[model samples]
Target: MSIKLDYKPVVVLTDYMYDSIQPFQDVYDRAGFEFRPYQCKTAEEIIQVAKDADAVQVHFAKITKEIIDALPKCRLIVRSAVGMDNIDVAAATAAGIPVANVPDYGIEDVSTHAILLMLAITKKFNILTRTVQEGMWDYAVTKPVHRIQNRVFGLMGCGAIARCAAKKAQAFGMRVIAYDPYLKQDQVNDLDIILKSAKEVAQESDVVSVHLPLTSETKEIIDREFFGWMKPGAFLINTARGGVIQERDLLQALQTGQIAGAGLDVLSQEYIEKDDPLLQMNNVIITPHAAWYSEEAEFTLLTSAAEEVVRGLNGEPLKHPFNKIPYAKQL
Candidate 1:
């Protein structure tokens, strides 16, 4: 007797991630599966599209419990990036839908972006670039830049991105230190990075780069007390999650020169209102959460995430499953 395989449709609920994953169309086609792309602008629309999907390819789209409940046919929910806060992992788990993410997809891109922010702030590139563009050559001569070499760089999280940042900082002739409770001392020593307390890392480093994931514990991790612990002219670079740093406290720190400057690629809100204080600051550089967005990174993210989907469909074990929530243990 011959057995028939059940091929289900994989719906992609995203904005523009379809374009990124276009290269993998052949892979999906060869697998004898239907690939449906839907641009879901709201949570409701996501639920509607995901209702009949066997697997979902998600990006920044919010996957709430409502959507999870609606996706009765969905056995897998794959995120294109590492962070799964946008998805209701507990609900997915309860629904028996495995959720995966591409954790190591943009390691170099993210690390490079963090370092770029650090270098830009330390060298005052933003000011210099604007001054030169405005034909203010005299200001450049008067306001000289600082060298990155011999400076201390601190990482708030010692994950893969942080480790990559440490390696890059060393290449630029800077000393690297990091603060992470989860990382072992031997691991830190192996990377040749100084392991210090969070307070010490903040106080001593010439430039502090935040690489921690956003969590209940890490939300507003860099608040007033954090700014107070930093060196007077120290710079800050946040290419990590937005809520990791408190915007109000950061604004006050910049206004009072508590910190020298900041290069931020992410914000607590993706689209801040017009009157937001961060918009009024001249010393701060803000990008629209594009630190992880590079041509190379996008390609890697799309290809890797697509591969994960294929793996899940083939009943193979996933390489980057995010449905396992350690924080859930507390509840």
Candidate 2:
């Protein structure tokens, strides 16, 4: 069988998701790019399969400069999820390629996950579950719990997802405070959330929920000193990327009882080592980075990502373009 390799530009999807990529076929056909699905993980794999691609839609694949530089025909890169940390944006910028992501797809799920974690940590839900399973029926194991009302719920970022979380937390009669220098105080005020300094939020809140993005500035932003500012026996929750917290520092604080507990949906390393200290602590609730999951949410995320690539290919502004488009070389 002779496969035709005409002058038509190609759109390569870096990896597959449980959801179908069939929706993209019509978009690709209309945009003059042939939709090609390829399974690529490492930098080398991406470079090999996407070398001639005009636009690349990356799922869980790493888009390194080596791969970016190798793709001479590539014009745009779209991340399947909210975070663009998986891709080397600087390298793509240097190569004159624009980077875009779907920032709003999982706002409902992730925010709800944050609220769930907050309540579980504060109420000692895991401890109670384990104790009951082990034949201990006494409620004394979870004694001295404070009421949720009037407690400060601190947010690290007041972005779309965090805003949704604020609304949910407020529904529980909790005061929502946030620290996000990117947004003006009035913007946070519009959401009925008090804008405070990072330290102030940490110092005052009974529970701190992180919803910040992972950037150079935000990486390891929550270190030992930040933990020191936390109220004694306060709870910490992270539904955002994990690089924002230093795990060793978090463990130390937990060990010293400076912080009461943590609810981590992500970790500094997603492939947590077998001997990870946090794994042994009952106060710590560790999930396999699945906060943004639901059968419905997964489909939305995949479908939205495919649509963003079509926009990129058409040289149209995306739903959430992370950076200023470095170039306009479109399909």
Candidate 3:
């Protein structure tokens, strides 16, 4: 699509949970462009609102191929979050629109959340707190709780967040081991984390934490087979995508005593039914996909996403490019 000489470039935000868009507006104002925010849930809605947009900053809205094809002037597509699964990156690349994401904004917050989950589940915080609130002052209500020190903590994917989690676990005197085929032993040598095979990590760890992105290859990667490998008393933590572990398998594992407990920050489905079995289980701790949250992180996420739009408009390289494409010519 050719640009119109008289046309003013516009940036569209498909959706956002923020109470204010001022962070985005500030960046767009300095760049001298229009910043439009819309709560679009469907491709048709996005197409109608962003047809003339020079860039699109998306948060949770699915930027499908249909929406991508409709944006004739779209030079960039930026996901406000770390994962690009919500946006069709391949479609954007084929259309010569580079896709970017804010990957670094939530590193500390998410890693910290992972550690929180670890401690809460291992310490039986839920059971103890609930029993106490019920006027039962017996410590025996949370019987069989174990110490964290010197226990094996296995990580499924040793990315930045997992590495940070390792440091936190180490501070509590836990031994950290990880399994990530993408990394070599030398890469993690400085951190003192032992790299092991997936099976070995599952078999040896007192707690197995998942830190993988949701992709075709990783969907349901932690299923019955992996659970079978885990010790019957071992715990499981997943602050990453929920689809990484099969929910049915996880429930079965928790029921049959194959695994002790689970701490989940995300789910395969965002909304769980009121009577979901996972919620009924006392051994489970679930958060509302809020691992990547903090007042500071929120500001950083919005600012970085807006900056990507500015970079695209200025023909500058994206700080976190998800796809490679020829830079769009300046208007």
Candidate 4:
């Protein structure tokens, strides 16, 4: 039942920031596809290098409409990460190109990281650790820490990662409430997560964790208005995209005591200047967008992305499609 094509398909990596493309190479080589990789940062570079690619793999490069229109032979686009914000999905849809992403690769790693942030902030680990190392062991510096038992844990989104977080939060004796427009109340009843409005979740929870993807609707969604709805002295955790929370408003919330503290794995900006005030705040914990890291997660992410490319070339079903395209065009 082996079918062979007369010509070898060309697969291009628009840009990959990782140290090695060995995973992609192995998949493409086994499939008898030509692998062309370029470290492109802009649409112009991608167009010049990969105009005739049959399938494209992207990492950090911005895939614009112009580049999509130029790729006359491209039928598939696979983002190497969970988020497809860099790719112009709408344009790809119009052109009948199927776009895909590796969404579930780091679910456990990211959800676990969110819970870690929650525990660290609740216990005031940052200030306590620093004070003791600075030759001061006064528990009074970070006093008033509250027990997490019986507290309300709210999730802004209830996707796979959020659902995982909900179970973990429940295990901590915290009541889990969530707001997800796409899910029904009964859908989450098995996990004991109460469905509520976003504003209700914000007001009721002692700790609000963000788990939504970054999109036009979600960009800067957690602004002053959302903060105003939150209970004073409540903690905020964002292991999702940085743009979901407005940085300036978050700073004001912290300054005015609207919220007690924040644990952010992602920021509005990836690399902040040393002078940025968020760095100086004792109540805030920031990680370098590394919530999706672990040896196992990295391997899954890389191999899953390559598997998608294989599916695209062999006309097999894509497991994680981001855009809808006719099956005929996908071939």
Candidate 5:
């Protein structure tokens, strides 16, 4: 007897997510499945686009319970990036849809970006650039810069990015410290990074970098109390999720000189309609969440996500399965 295989429709969610999907277009085409790309800007649009899709490729867009319930045919939700916090994982699981992500896609790129942010802030690069651009030679000379050597560098989460940052910091002759309850002492010791409590990391470090995922326990993790514990004249660098640090509190901290400065690659809102408080603060540097946006990282992310999709289609185990439930439960 001969058996026939069915090719399911795979939907690419939005324009912003297309760059990661474009590279894999040929792969999907050759796999004998229908590839549908939609420019969905809202949750309603996402539901409509993914309504008949067998798998939906998603980015930072919201994937609510209503959308998940609407997508009756969606067998998988493939996230182009590592973070799955934007998607309603529980709802997807209930709907019998497995979520897949590309977790290791941007580790080196993001870690390098974090270190760049730290170095820029420590040396007052942004201020110096503005002063020079305005033709104020005296202002450029007035700005003071600090060396990285012998300074204490703290990491909030000892994940891939944190580990990468620790290694880079050590190479620069900085003392690296990290606080993560999930990490074993032996593991931390092996990295040659100091293990400290969250409060202690905040208090003792001259430069603090946040690398944790955003969860209920970590949301607004850096607030007034957290900032209060930091050493005076220290710098804060956040290459992690935006919500991890409260924007309003950060503005106040900057205005009050609570800390010397900050380098932020992510924000609570990507598209701010009005002049945000953070923008008004001269001491704060902001990037449009481009920490994981390097060409090399984008290629890795694209290829990784594509491989996951192909693996799913082939009925094989995914390289980065976001949810791995029991087979009995899945059935």
Candidate 6:
């Protein structure tokens, strides 16, 4: 009986990832786990595909309450990205499954993306490119560009990515200031960035960048009032969650010229509709939420998520567990 009692974990991927799992298959097998990939897009599909899974890794699949309730054997959910907004975290918590994310996997990539957006907006990269393509090379048309040096680069949240962004901004000769209630004064001091309230940061910055997580309190934090405080002609960049800034307010602000331009990597909706107003605005630079991607980052993200599943199945602590729950039953 003792010899026969062995744990064989079933680690199911909620959706396909770019990184192949073949390389890590042997590692999982050695640890008494099996890795299986699925292309489940709906709740019912997820329930059918992962009902018997001991652990699951998610990329873009929405793990709803129905799927959570149906998975009787699932003990862990590891999101490939930092944001777990796509997954129903509350439902998973209630069901006693710990949710983990690869929070540090793409810090450099995301920070670089933030800087890229900032430079594009300041230099009018898109419109200038379009002008040249239209057989016009009027450099004066892109005149009136203010130097980034000596300009303020304001940040909303000072997490790992934000810290790197601050360092990069400073290297470009921009002054950095941040608004993050969670960080202590000493932490901000160590970064050599002035710590201020959100309103103050918005008012003083020449280029304001958002780098916060999406939570109930943070959703729509950058509404009309917050936008109203921003310095006129200042550009805005959001490498953070899209819901952090309200789209309606942002649209109004842009229409009124409250801000000079905007660069968004995420939107309230990931897929920008064909008729969206932002699409018509020549000042906005929008990317399809690809801030957290690089060959190395994707590999790290995929492997890290798989490792979390192994840890959860073996009753070990997860590296980047986001939620708090009492001792969960292990596989």
- The prediction achieving the highest lDDT against the true structure is 3
- Give candidate 3's TM-score: 0.96
Regions of candidate 1 where Cα sits further than 4 Å from its true position: 1-6, 17-20, 139-144, 272-280, 325-331
Estimate the TM-score of every prediction: 0.90, 0.93, 0.96, 0.96, 0.91, 0.93
The prediction achieving the highest TM-score against the true structure is: 4
TM-score winner, 3 or 6: 3
Q: Report the number of backbone clashes for model 5.
A: 0
What digit string (tens of lDDT, one per residue) describes model 2 on residues 62-144?
88888888999888888878988889999988877889888888999999999999999889999899999999998889987
Angstrom error at residue 207, model 6 = 1.0
What clash pairs does model 5 have?
none
State the displacement of the C-alpha of residue 30, model 3, in Å, after optimal TM-score superposition.
1.7
Q: Lowest summed lDDT over 10 consecutive residues: which window, candidate 4?
A: 322-331
TM-score for predicted model 1 compared with the true structure: 0.90
Clashing pairs in 3: none
Off by over 4 Å in 4: 1-4, 326-331
**Candidate 3 Cα outliers beyond 4 Å, as residue runs:** 1-7, 326-329
If both were scored by lDDT, which would come out higher, candidate 4 or candidate 5?
4
Per-residue lDDT of candidate 1, residues 1-331 (tens digit): 1112653546564555444557456667766667776778998888776677767888888888988887677778888888877888888888777888888988888899998888777777677787788888755542546788999999999999989989999999999999999977887787899899999999989999999988878999999999999997898999889889988899899999999889999988778788877767667777777788778788788778777777776676777778652111100
Superposed Cα deviation of residue 71, candidate 3 (Å): 1.5
Ranking by TM-score: 4, 3, 6, 2, 5, 1
Q: Could you give me the TM-score of model 6 versus the true structure?
A: 0.93
lDDT of 3 at 159: 94
| lDDT digits (tens) for residues 238-324 of candidate 6 | 999999999999999998988888999999887988899898987899999899989888777767777776766677767778886
- Estimate every model's Cα lDDT from 0 to 1: 0.81, 0.86, 0.90, 0.89, 0.80, 0.86
lDDT of 4 by residue, 166-246 (tens): 889889999999989999999988989999999999999999999999999999999999999999979999999999999
**1-331, model 5: which lDDT tens digit per residue?**
1113644546555435543466677667777667776667888898777787767877777788998898777767788887778988888888777888888988998899899999888887777788889887765463566788999999999999889988999999999988898977888787898789999999999999999888888999899999999887899999988889987787778889888899999877676545777766667778878888878888777777766776675566667677783121111
- Candidate 5: 10-residue stretch with minimal lDDT: 322-331
Off by over 4 Å in 6: 1-5, 17-30, 325-328
